[model samples]
Target: MSTRAITGDQWVVLRVPISGEGVTAEVAAFAARRQLRYDLGDDGTLRITDPESARVIVTVRWKTLPPQVPRTLGFQLPSAAAVDVLIDPGPGLAAGRIAAALHDALSGRALAYTDGELEGIRAAMPLLERYSAARPAFDNWALIFRDHYLEHSTGFVLAMERAGIPAEWIFALDKGDRTWNRERVHATFQARGYRSDVLDNTAVNLPHAHGDELARVGADIDAFLDAAHTAGRRVLVVDDGGLLARGYGAIGAPRTADAALELTVSGIKRIAAAGPLAIPVLNLARSQVKSRLGYREIADSCMRRLQALLPDRKLIGRQVLLLGYGTLGSRLAAQLRGLGCRVVVVDSDLPALIDAAESGFTTYRTAGQALAATSPFIVVGTTGERALSDADLDLLPDGLVLAPFATRDFCALTENAVHRGGASDIPGVGMRFALDRGRRVTLLGNGRSMNLFEADSIPNEGYDAYRAGTFIAAASLCADPGRVPAGLHTAPADDAIAEAGLWSAYYDLYAAQGKGAVRPPTVPAPRLADLPAPVPF
Candidate 1:
């Protein structure tokens, strides 16, 4: 040996706190190939044991950065997790990318994974530490469930187990109910013309859900809230109404700041008051949270909201067709009915159509069946399914007042219809969801690939790529190489690249440590040969 240095070798332990076990193989595989000795640290830390010498240097790989830019989690050592990676102002950057890579390498299969951004309430502080005799974390980290996808759950579990993080601390409880926070089902957008169910309720209503009924609903909500308050578990509330829908309305804990998730907006003060709380209230409409100008959502929002200012002159008055009355459409239908417009909700589902009818909103099965004035009012498609037709357009003439709020083509059907039906290609406007006025806006653009039918209403498929990346990173870290707390990680791609870049800079700093101490890039991160068992210290 030509006097190998001890600077770049150690048993890297990754305490992956996820629900699945994979990506572990990748770390090991990578390490094996690079001939790096990796030891799995069971006590929530990846212990890289073998170096050329016994002298140790800690590298801080705090979570939160790097979809490209690594932002620091402000990890301090009142009892710091081991680290030497920070170059004075290290950690955080490029971390997000690392996280994404890890998640995919590990639990990519399951986990309706999306890239999360771990935003800190405090100023982007330096990684200061309160040392407690060289140990791991002093405060326990938390993990919560956001959905019931078995893949996510399994992947999370597997990742955590493989990382060798203790099981007791990582909770993985799933909300047994599916409709807990479903938006489309509970009806968030449309609020005018009635649905069949509302019609049915109105048709045979002995009385409205009130008085004693309201009391009953209130009690149930209280019970749910009480349970959450007592637990203080940092839970991931995972129902699909874009993330908030307790129809007939009874959300537990109006004071929603508990460790126990399903945390509602009600308890903001209390929740925020409880320590350094990181509230990642899922922006159901993130598909629209951006832009230089105030956010612009589907034109319909302007149409619907017009009621508050003009009250009677609401957008509902415009001729409109409410398609797919699940959660997204139902509200749109109601909103249309409010604006004094002739509204017809078309859906194959008899019950939904019936609900639409009940709500004072007319219901039709298909666009074909409900053909009124060809180019009637605004044709807003809500179902994440198909598109519109040319025949339907022929009647409406103002060239189909349209808005596509999806990643895929809502106008696909109509696009095809135009092509198939041999009519002049009259394309609909595309809505781009962006952030504006501090809230979000869906900006309607000209093209279709990046911005048509892309939801301003909710963000289901919108964040899949980023989420996928985080999952990949987390999983990779969980490998016998490295893993960090999978909690509250806000990984923006910008942050990920930043971290790597920072790492490079830090390496340079380490080399120039003054006094003529010179060195080349610290040996590259060793590759894993195979997913290995946690090597003992």
Candidate 2:
């Protein structure tokens, strides 16, 4: 084989000899089989060039190959004949080695391979290896963002661009409204010379088409993914929860999973179970403590809205039923108590109920007992799951208020009742849903997230922490995947500390710009005192 280096380029030109009889015909046949383009010289020399820089060559004499050259490429060639397969390491030596190792292992390598060799191969596939080697991780990365308004999404793209990574945005407009400033997002992408696409929530339910209306939208998503794959770009899906996951799963799981990296706020549990590296950037317990403040924001917002809508009904001295004593529930409970409301906590999870009990609050294993006893003036559901069933709705007192702090599903029963003329709002109270037969119940934000719907958005200070933590997590993942195990991993401790510093800097920056700044409250570290004492089931 003859080799020569090209100046200022990582690529090199190499010639591998095919010495057997009918060498030209054999090489031509192999190239044709591999769908490789080639040309035959007048001297009968067969030459093949890769459209991209990568090329692979294989021959029977593996031992004769250069020591610096990788052996994994040789394993891919047909063993039946002596053939020279030339491969160009377009992504540089490190990526080439990693890709070759993965391909080699996936293509049925010998079982005799030692653990040390496997570890060495895995270590080569770190997220930043390609970037560090002067090769792009992919031609471009597709960023599937749940909220375009969130600074995190925009900031992430900006950071990646600064690092010399080409990225595009795919925004999920869940409500299909122009309120999200579509024009502004488009203008930003255009000014930055990046491509972007918008998809609505309907795409989540695939194969069940909504006639011609949503067909084009579905086609858009498909075309976007196809273009990314064709261009050899990787996809990084940053979603709030199940929307993108379900959409991707609906389209085709294997192919989508192969090309995308999913970072979710709420769906990491499900995604991690499927054997992919699902980074939890937004989980309440794992990533950042900012969500605790978000919960407080939602609670405070809901209380203020309630007061404005019904000035006669005060939250102080009211009996409140709180469901799901998780991160949101616990924080909201504390806030409600501080506001002079007596909070009764209920959760199906025994440990959660016990924790609430241990926290010096009244606890109930079921909503029935709490409802019957309290006849609560206000009911707040913080569990991500459906907290109120039809039966639970029937048990509610005539004049009561319902608020879902976690997700919109908590208000499903109220929504259904309202549609059926079983619920209606009091005349003077805004967002107060009253039931038929003179029964009145106020449903806050119609069961949607109070923080988003009532509070307008997450507090800027909390959002800063969330975004900073996410930035550090993404960068850390890229720099070293070996440090992160293949499962749902907590945000790095360093990221949490960095998040605080980042938030402080952000506050100072805001102040310097003459904008009033609100520094996030220092969240006390979680204490084990809230843990439930062991009680044999």
Candidate 3:
């Protein structure tokens, strides 16, 4: 927690003479701003870098209170850096605090990682934040998931849910999500088995405002309003308030509640009073209710969808770095390990490292340590910070930095990370892969699947196909999930539709003939094997 680091994992910068500008000083200064702790007390050697990303471009033996046997060590400080890396600090710092510190360390500062270095680290922040976030609220309502995970901490409510009551569970939503989240519904249901026919009541009993119905309901609306006024009606729904005239004729109920919890208040209290009723109404807008509910089905569906989209990355003789070990990272690790990847998880949060460790993830507190040991197969950032630094960029290995949360800062950090002491100029291309009918079958029998595998060969219940399709869909959204890669690209909507259509065709193509479905396209025969192997280059 207190930045107490273990060593042997040092970014050894290959030394050049220090005559002009003490590069070490610059490095030290940059690090100091980030509040990195280090002391340059050695045999004219300074070692600097986080445990995960430092390269030791040149390794020199530094003498700390004690001297070592090797008068010198051979390694170079890494100049190659990714924009994002995991940080490890004592229990004192929150993720937000650390991010602010790093931003100040580099922005408008001197002795910072080279311009190239800064860009690379910034590139991966948003992605890391995503990974660093607590478990996401489940939204995929169509699948099964663990119920307790999506619960909103209420015993009475949870009890009703587990009892299979036809209870309509709802939650207030001022916390910014607009759509009804399926995960919340599913989780609650899973925890408490309910014979619930889930419905979206936010738009209850009214024509959609955008459709022609709103206009149609308009002129008739005023007539209802006039009738209510003439009847001397006053809206009322209370147990005791002495006798008073109550409004009986109203055209429609209020469309939306002013606040989330208020939505369930009035109607729900009445329903609850009807002890042991079959159709129970749980008021979600009762102020203290959670903003969103969690549900098992939603969780399962999301998990499945995510698992489907995730590429089964393998270590199989490759080096790799896993930036953040929060929920996303945990899932990613499990999947990758299944694919035979050697994973090492890094995080600034001690609890995170502990979680990963307990879960059997190779946990690390710093990027510098991971870098000192080996170049990774891939560098995946999950924390929501610009973790990489100029010093880090100057020493990266030749590999890909997969950012699950790519943003402008993330792109810039990675784009400008110092490679070989300077900014990288090798711009990458954004490419897409689809199961284009091949003369012969393959991931790219003309096009690679978004799962990064060929169609049939792509494992995991056609997840690759779905991913491929989503790439096209993402492209259509002009939403570059990552940097505007320089090469080929898999657009979002186009690819998503293709994958969807393919799956539909695979199952229903034959049904078009007024019967059961027929098999769509079969994997081509092996006879065309000599036809150029889908242009891997």
> Which one is best on TM-score?
2
List CA RMSD, all candidates. Answer: 23.1, 22.7, 27.6
User: Model 2 segments beyond 4 Å from truth?
Assistant: 1-139, 148-218, 247-254, 257-265, 269-285, 289-312, 408-437, 480-486, 491-537
Q: Which whole-number lDDT from 0 to 100 does residue 225 have in model 2? A: 66
Better of 2 and 3 by TM-score: 2
Candidate 1 — number of clashing residue pairs?
187
- Please give each candidate's TM-score: 0.28, 0.56, 0.26
Each prediction's whole-model lDDT (CA): 0.33, 0.48, 0.31
Candidate 3 residue runs with Cα over 4 Å from true position: 1-257, 260-317, 405-537
In candidate 2 the C-alpha lDDT for residue 148 amounts to 40
In model 1, which regions exceed 4 Å deviation?
A: 1-316, 373-375, 390-393, 406-409, 413-537
- The sequence of per-residue lDDT tens digits that candidate 2 reaches over residues 88-165 is 333345434432432232222121222232222222221111112222432355555454433234444444564545
For candidate 1, write residues 1-537 as lDDT tens digits. 112212222213233223212333444553355444444455433322225642212222323222222112122112212211211111232322333333333322222122121111011100100000122221222232333222222333333323333344333332222221222221211121111011111111112433464344335444444554465432223222211232211234254322222221212222333333223332222211111011222334434323322333235346766667765566556556665778877888999888888888767788766766233545565554454554543434333444433322244433343333433232232332212233221213221211211112212212222232232323222221113231222233223323324223323433357665533212221122221122111
Clashes of 3: 124
lDDT of 3 at 359: 84
